[model samples]
Target: MHAPGIWGIIVVAIVVILLFGRGKIAGLMGEVASGIKSFQKGMRDEENKPAAQIDASTTVEPVAQPEKKDA
Candidate 1:
């Protein structure tokens, strides 16, 4: 089927606005915008950081075990 033209899109938009008040639509749009912004920020942060950066203090050394006596 062919895609809806400008008039069809406009009619759909009007119907949606009528069903859900302007305030609710505006709030949803705001939330969507914020989510997109947050995603972009996370992507940028991931790009800047190193793949692996372990601290020396956090590393654990293996402990020595005592030998068992024969029966």
Candidate 2:
């Protein structure tokens, strides 16, 4: 199948806007922008975190059990 040209894309966009209204589209765009921003901030925070803290949070220590003695 042939890929959609610029005109086809524009027509689809217009139809979607007509169906959803401008305000709804704008709000959806705003939500998408905020979600992208939050994801970027989270990535930055993870990169800036201390390696030791990350390691400490993930590592598990083995527990020692008491030796059994036979009577």
Candidate 3:
């Protein structure tokens, strides 16, 4: 099958933008950018954190159960 030409792509983009509106598209783009920045910040924060803290939190602790009482 023949791929869509440049005009086809442009028309699709225009239709999408018209349906969505410029402000809505810009807001969504802003939200996406902020989400990416937040993810990067979280990763950086994790990397900067101490390994001991991470390991300590992840360590499993077993709870002691009381012996069963006979009814």
Instruction: State which candidate has the highest lDDT.
Output: 1
The digit string of per-residue lDDT tens for model 1 on 1-71 reads: 99999999999999999999899999999999999999999999999998996878888889988999999
lDDT value, residue 65 of candidate 1: 88
Ranking by lDDT: 1, 3, 2
Model number with the top TM-score: 3
lDDT of 2 at 29: 96
Among residues 3 or more apart in sequence or in different chains, the pairs in candidate 1 whose N, CA or C atoms overlap within 3 Å are: none
List model 2 lDDT by residue over 3-69, tens digit each.
9999999999999989999999999999999999999999999999978545556788799999999
> Which consecutive 10 residues in model 1 have the weakest lDDT in total?
52-61
Give all candidates' CA lDDT scores: 0.96, 0.94, 0.94
Q: Estimate each model's TM-score.
A: 0.60, 0.61, 0.70
Which ten-residue region of model 3 has the weakest summed lDDT? 50-59
Q: State model 2's lDDT.
A: 0.94
- How far residue 36's Cα lies from its native spot in candidate 1, in Å, is 0.6
Model 1 residue 51 CA deviation (Å) reads: 1.6
Q: Kindly indicate the candidate among 2 and 3 with the higher TM-score.
A: 3
